[model samples]
Target: MTVTIRDASLADLSVIASIYADAVLTGTASYEIVAPDETEMKKRFQSVTSQGYPYIAAVDESGDVLGYAYASAFRTRPAYRWLVEDSIYLAPAARGKGIGRLLLAELVARCEALGFRQMVAVIGGASPASIAVHQACGFRMVGTLTGTGFKLGQWLDTVFMQIALGDGNASEPDPESYPGTLFAG
Candidate 1:
């Protein structure tokens, strides 16, 4: 399939919500017990895009959204402005197709271009597939939180992986620049 990656639009929220709902219901990638409705997904999309964070979708030749990814503030504190967290979800048919890597690579590139110094992937349930994709994109295993989540009638671990963007910590960021108003006083 010829897949294209582009900025996610308001119209895409329905499919995005469906994909996320599937993950929430059937997979450990998300920790939420209930899949949020489309309205909630729309709110999240606006929250991310309004903050100037990159939110992208991967679509097939027919323009169907196969997967989506985005970067969001890792933390609300000013000190964490340089770090951003990544989230990705794919349709059931899209898994193991390298689409995750494509979406993640694009996210990393866009975040770096926006001056973010680091990107972190907090893999829920310590999913091996998620870890493999992150590793393929140059993220290194940082740490793992064992038994941090309970879902599907069992305990799950949360894994942390990180990758440096741009100059990373080698140089300090300009005080005047940041992803949107996340650091605004």
Candidate 2:
């Protein structure tokens, strides 16, 4: 399957919502107990894109969305402006086909190009597959919070993996050129 990664559009939200809903319903990647509807997804999409964050989708040759990924502020505070967090979700058929890796790589490149210095992956449930994909994209295991989440009738751990983008912390960010709307006062 030829998969292309591109900026997500409003038309893609339906499929994106489906993909995320499935993940929330059946997988531990997302902690939400109830899958959100398309309206809610639209609000989230607007929130991310409005802030100039990179929200992307992986589409098949026929123009079907197979998966999606995006980078959002790790925290809304001004002090964390240079840091962003990544989230990725794939359709059931898209798993294990390296789609996650592709989405993550593209997301990383886009974030770096935008001048983000650090990208963090907060892997809910500490999913092995998620961890491996992040590792393949040059993220390193930072720490794991055991029993941090409870779902599916059991306790789950949350893993933290991080990668340096651009110059990372080796040099200071140019205060004159903050990336995106994240630095808006």
lDDT (CA) for every model shown? Answer: 0.95, 0.95
Across 1-185, the per-residue lDDT of candidate 1 in tens digits comes to: 89999999999999999999999999998999999999999999999998889999999999999999999999988899899999999999999999999999999999999999999999999999999999999999999999999999999999999999999999989977775777776
Question: What are the models' TM-scores?
Answer: 0.98, 0.98
Give the Å shift of residue 92 in candidate 1. 0.3
Backbone clashes, candidate 2: 0
Candidate 1 accuracy as TM-score: 0.98
Q: Tell me how far the alpha carbon of residue 93 in candidate 2 is from the true structure, in angstroms, after superposition.
A: 0.5
